[model samples]
Target: MQIRPFELERYFARHEFSAKYLLGSSDPEAMSIADLLAFEPGSEEELKRVWLGYTESLGDPALRRDIAGLYESVAPEEILVFTGAEEPIFAFMHAVLEPGDHLVVHFPGYQSHYSVAQSRGIEVSHWHGNPNRNWAPDLVELPELIRSKTRAILICTPHNPTGYLFDRSSWQQVIEIARERDLYLFCDEVYRGTEHDPADQLPHLADHYEKGISLNCLSKNCGLAGLRTGWIATKDRDIYNRLATFKDYLTICNCAPGEYLAGIAVRNMPQIFEQQRVRLVSNLNLLAEFFARHTDLFSWQRPRAGTVTFPRYLGGSALEFCDWLVAETGIMLIPGTFFDMPGEYLRFGYGRASFADALARLDAYLAG
Candidate 1:
């Protein structure tokens, strides 16, 4: 299948390692394998003992059980593991959606949410969020975006870049809309556990709606991107089976050691989430101060959750500014152009422990 170039991933490939400071990454600070195994006293030996043979395509049973516990009503049998969140998305695009089918997606989102489908000749409509309203999409516009061919509504909560977490009421409205149209709901919940306020967290869409497919990964919330573990949770057995079958064409099974490590991470999520939350909150405070100081150069709104925030650059073109900033100071920030967004917006990430240091460098650059 022909697909458009993945602008964001390609950009990261070029600079993610060489850049001195990454102010646009979405994952929280990662922990070492030793630190992860420390969560359970005997896990290190267990990890060492992990069989290097092929793992179950449905994922390690224990890992599925642990993932099941994250949802309120989903079972381990309903979970289909993938190499990462990207594979499941690709699976859904090929396995479920058809050429004539239509999809409605949250705007300024991860490109794959719509790109793969677009490549397959599916129609896509963006449900754009209002930046003036702290990036919240108007619920009223949602119903109107649906058409008879619309097969699904895709969204991200504790969203990437903008950090827009839906209030429970708005969250329900989205599910209800999908329910009314008998359309599937796909939620990119990779950032689910990183809410700035725990109360603001919404229920896993799969638990609340029968047609919902909730996608999650260890990369974002657990800061375990290297593990490359992600899964889909859905109550619908048919959908689960379809995704599982499609997996045969992809990474048939996940990495054996990665699954073992993922199991350890999932079993110990409470502490892991707490660790990320503490760091996120601390970095957010520093970001607020930095933004306050640079009001002349940026239009900012503190996001409710997630690792990154999109702010408007008062400087000429966001792309130009980011290019100049990175070249001059070795600090990397993503321009909104990468998200298919126009105007002067740029994504700023505050998930890393080095965020303060990065912000300091940007501040110093501005001063000089």
Candidate 2:
């Protein structure tokens, strides 16, 4: 199978390590492995007992059980864990989609949501979210995008870059469409737990739709990216079996250490999420003020979820602006063009302590 480059991952590979202050990262401030191990009262002793061996290919049973508890209705066995959110997306696209199978993907999203399937010769239609309307897709447009060969409707809620969360009505509309069309619903719920109002949290797509597959990870809400543990939860046993079999060809099993740490993180998800959400809300307020102070230079709406926001730059190409900012101030912000939107926008991640400092530097640069 011919595969094209993953644009965002490639950009990270080139700059992630060397960048001094990363203001483009999507993951929240990460918790160290030690922090995760220390979550429980007697975790120190439990940590010492963790074995170093090939873990269950389906993921450690305990971790799956803990993850299952996050959803309203799903069992541990129905979840198939993968190395990261990225891997499951690839596995699903390859395992389920075929050449000429039609896919409806939410646009201005993480590129992989569409590009990877397109690379495999799938007929892809974009469900575009209008930037003018708080970066939301019209639920009414979806039915028109469906066809006889349509196999899936892929969506990312509390989306990447834009951070727009779909309301209950929107999600209900999607569920109805998928049920009526008999199409698979692939919902990337990586940012599911980060709702501004916890009540805004929606049911796992798998629980809501027979063919729905809900993708999640420890990376975003739990701030456990280094664990590299993510999973796909589906009511469809066929998909679970296919992804489980496909796992052998990719990452056969989760890393023993990553799995161990992920188990602890999952078990303590409530506390972990609480800490991170507090930080995110605090930082988002700061970001709102920062944007207000520089209204002339950037156009942004305060995001409802996620750590990052894509802001339009009124002057110059984002690449040129970002390169100049990094070179002059040692602050790194991603050029939005990397995600296929260019010239006018760059992604600013306000999830880190250095975000304010970086904004100050950019302000100084703009002034000078």
Candidate 3:
């Protein structure tokens, strides 16, 4: 099947290594492998002993159990691990969704959510987020988007770009719609623990909906992007088996080292996320002040959760403005065009160790 270029990933490839300050990275302040191994005693020895051969196609049993512990109702047997969140998304669309199958996906989301299926000629209807209402999708629109061929509804909670979280009622509304229509709910929940407020945490989609596929990874919440490990948790046996078998053609199993580290990361989720939360609040406060001071230049709502926010650039041409800003300040911000969103918007991420310094550069740029 012909594939569309992933603009966001492509843009990252071009600038991620060379940028002076990465202000638009989605992952939180990542740790050195030493820091990751430091969490658990004897981890250094375990890493040395980690087998080099292919691991279980499903995942390491220990790792799967640790991942299962993150959910309320999901079990180790129900989890299917992958190389990354992106790979499982590709597997699910290819293995479950076929051409002519209709998909309802959140708009202004990660491009791969809808684009892969669209590339397959799958009929796609966007569940658009309202900029007028802090970038939330109207649940009232779900019924209208459903059709006989509508096989799934995809969403990203504590979402990317906009960082919009569905309130309790809004969250239930989606589960209800999928249950009523028997549509698969593919929830990209990689940003699950990045909520600005603990009270705002939503139930794990896998635990709540029988057919819901909850996608998660160590990259975002745990700040272990180098692990490249992600997994889907669900109670649906058929879905689990299907994706597990499909894994053969792609990465048969995760890297043994990545799995070892990911298991450690997930098992110690509370500590890792607590650190991230503290840093998130600090950076978000900086972002709040930055935006308030330059209200004339930018329009943004402080993100309720997650590290990134989509802001409308009041200055000319978001792409051009980002280009000039990066060139002058050595700080990189993702242009809105990558996600196929409104022209004036750009994704700004403040979830890194360097965010403070990056914000200072931005402050200098705006002041000058």
Candidate 4:
């Protein structure tokens, strides 16, 4: 089936390699393979020996087990690996949705969440997150969007761009809605582990909803985007089987080396999260100061978790500002319009150690 272009990905493709300061990236500062390998006692030799053969189609059992350990209730048997979070989302929408099925999707979201479904002729309704509420979706709007044909509720927590984390109560309310509506709950939890406080991490959706499908990856939180390893955890046996069957036509199996490195990353998640948390907290404070200094030209609601935040530009259109900033100072920032958001806002990722440097350059650019 054909699909519309993924606008954000398309924009990245053209500028990502050429850009100087990548303030638009979603992943935190990435860790080297050597750093990740150091987590295990005997990893040096094992990493050197990781073969080039095709890995298990269902993913290496040990790797799946390591991923399962992240959730309290899921087992390794229920996890199915994919190339990346993007793959599972595309596969899932194709595997589960039909032409007339209605889907409730979070708006101002990652483009693929709705675009792929829309391509299949699925009826999609947006559940909007108001900017006045720090980009949090009103659960009140959910039921009104649901129709008899509604089949799924899609969400992103520790959400992309906005970094809004749902409290446990919000999670429970959404699960209750899905349960009552008989709709599948597809929660993209790729950023779940990056909560500002470890204690604030919410339960995996698969554990809380019978038909929930939780998608995760080593990209954002683990800072192992190069691994391209992601998975889906679901309690529904039927969906699990269907996804597996559908997988055969796509990537028959994951890359063997990436699997090994990702296994190492997953096993040392505690250290990774700790390092990333410290960086995010520090950078976010710097971002706060930056925005405060330019309050008249820009406005932002500090995010609760994750690597990025979308801020409104009072000076000019986001696209115009981003283009001028990049051309003048070699600092790259994403215009919110790339995510189908209004042109006044832009996404800024401040999880990198270079965030201060980027901010300084932006300051100079804006002053000139």
Candidate 5:
């Protein structure tokens, strides 16, 4: 099945490697394997001995258990590993949705959340987020958008770009909507551990909703994108079995080495989250000051979680401003149009080591 180009990934491909300041990256600062295993004894030896062969199709048992520990209700048996978060999205949309099925997805958000379903000729509706309310979607509008063909609701909390998260009440309302309608829930929770406050961390969708599917990976929160490992957690036996069957045609098993590293990383999640939390809180403060200084040039609602902030570019079109900024300062930022957003907004990611330097450069570039 053919699909529209993933604009966000495409833009990153062109600039991610060469940009001097990676101010557009959403993943947090990554650590060396040595750094990751510094506190865990004997991890290095086990990694060296991790057999270089196809791993269990269902995922390595040890790794699955660590992943299951991330949730309150999910078990090791309910988790299925894949190449990355992207893979489960493709697999789930294909296995569970049909050509005429209707899907309601978060808007001004990630492309993959809707594109895969759209490619299948499904009727997809945008559940628009309110900039007026820190990009929160109005629960009142969800039912109006639903049709008899509606089959699934796709949600991203601590959402991409805007970093909008559903509070306890808001989250429960969403679950109630799905339950009332019998619609499957697909929650892309790759940024689960990136909450600005540890207290704000929500319950895992898979653990709370019987049919909810939680897609997570080592990319964003764990800062282990190189691992190329992601998994799906759900209590639905039928979907679990169907996704397993579908994987035979795609990647039947994960890379053995990546699995070992992912296992080690998940096992030490508390440290990773704390490390990332300090960085994000610091960066968010810097961004707030930057925006305040240039009040006329930008307007933004500070995000509640996640690394990126979609700020409206008041000086010019986001694409043009980003292009000029990169050419003039070697700092990279993303245009909101990439996410089908109809505003002059830039998706600035402030979750890296060099983010302060990038902001300083942007300040100089704007002044000149």
Candidate 6:
């Protein structure tokens, strides 16, 4: 199947490694292997004994059990593991959608949400978020976007870039709309555990809706991007089977060592999430102060969750500003154009240990 080049990944390929400070990364600060293994006693010894062989295609049983623990109603048998969140997304596009199918997706989101479907000749309608409302999409507009051929509604809560999480009422409204239309509800919950306020955390969609598919991974909230382990949890047996079958054409099984390590991370997620939450909250505070001081150069809205935030750049085109900023300062900020959003907006990530230093450098550059 022919597909357009992934704009965000392509941009990252050009600069992610070379940039001195990554101020546009979406994942939190990652821990070393030693730091992660330290969470479980004797895990270091267990890692040494992991067999270097093909693993269970559905996923390691123990790891699936640990992942199932994240949801209230989903079972290990219902979860399908993949190399990363990307695989399941690709699989769903090929396995469930057809050339004439229609999909409604949350706008200004990860490219794969729509790009893969588009490649297969599917129609995609964007459900956009409002900047004035802290990026929350209006529920009333949802039903209007659905067509007779619509098959599913895809969303990213505790969203990427904007960090706009849905409140319980709004989330329920989305579920209701999908249910009324008998449509599949696909939620990209990669940033599920990063709510700044624990009280604002929403339940896993699979647990609450029979047709809901919750796509998650170790990359964002768990700060274990190196593990490259992710999964889809769904109570719909048919959907689970379809995704599992399509995965065989991709990476049939996960990295055995990555699965074992993921099991460790999942088992001790409370502590791991706490570590990331603490760092994220600290960086967010600094960002608040930085944006407040530079209101003349940008417009800001504090995000409800996730590692990144979209701010409007008052200084000319955001693309040009990002290009100039990275070239002149070696600190990288992603332009909104990569997310299919162009003009004045740019994405700033505050999930790294170097956020303070990077912000300071930008501040100094502005002052000069």
Between 5 and 6, whose TM-score is larger?
Answer: 6
Off by over 4 Å in 6: none
TM-score versus the correct structure, for each prediction = 0.98, 0.96, 0.98, 0.98, 0.98, 0.99
Cα lDDT tens digits, model 1, 161-200, are: 7999999999999999999899999999999989988778
For model 4 the local lDDT of residue 169 reads 95
Model 2 per-residue lDDT tens digits across residues 117-148: 98899988989877778788988899999999
Best candidate according to lDDT = 6
The segments of candidate 3 whose C-alpha lies over 4 angstroms from its true place after superposition are none
Clashing pairs in 4: none
Per-residue C-alpha lDDT of model 5 across residues 96-120, encoded as one tens digit per residue: 8889999999888889889989999
Candidate structures ordered by lDDT, highest first:
6, 1, 3, 5, 4, 2
Q: Give the CA lDDT, 0 to 100, for residue 27 in model 4.
A: 88
Q: Write the per-residue lDDT of candidate 6 for residues 194-304, one digit (tens) a residue.
A: 999888999999999999999999999988899999999999989998898888899999999999999999999888888889999999999999999999999999998
State the lDDT at 103 in candidate 2.
95
- Write one digit per residue (lDDT tens) for candidate 3, span 1-368: 67889999998888766789898889899999899888999999989999899899999999999988888888899899998899999999888898999999998899999889999989899999888799999888889999999999999998998999999899998999999999999999999999988889998999999999999998888888888999999888888888988888999877999898888899889899999999999999999999999999999887799989999999978998888877777889998889887479998898898999999888987898
Q: Lowest-lDDT window of 10 residues in candidate 2?
A: 353-362
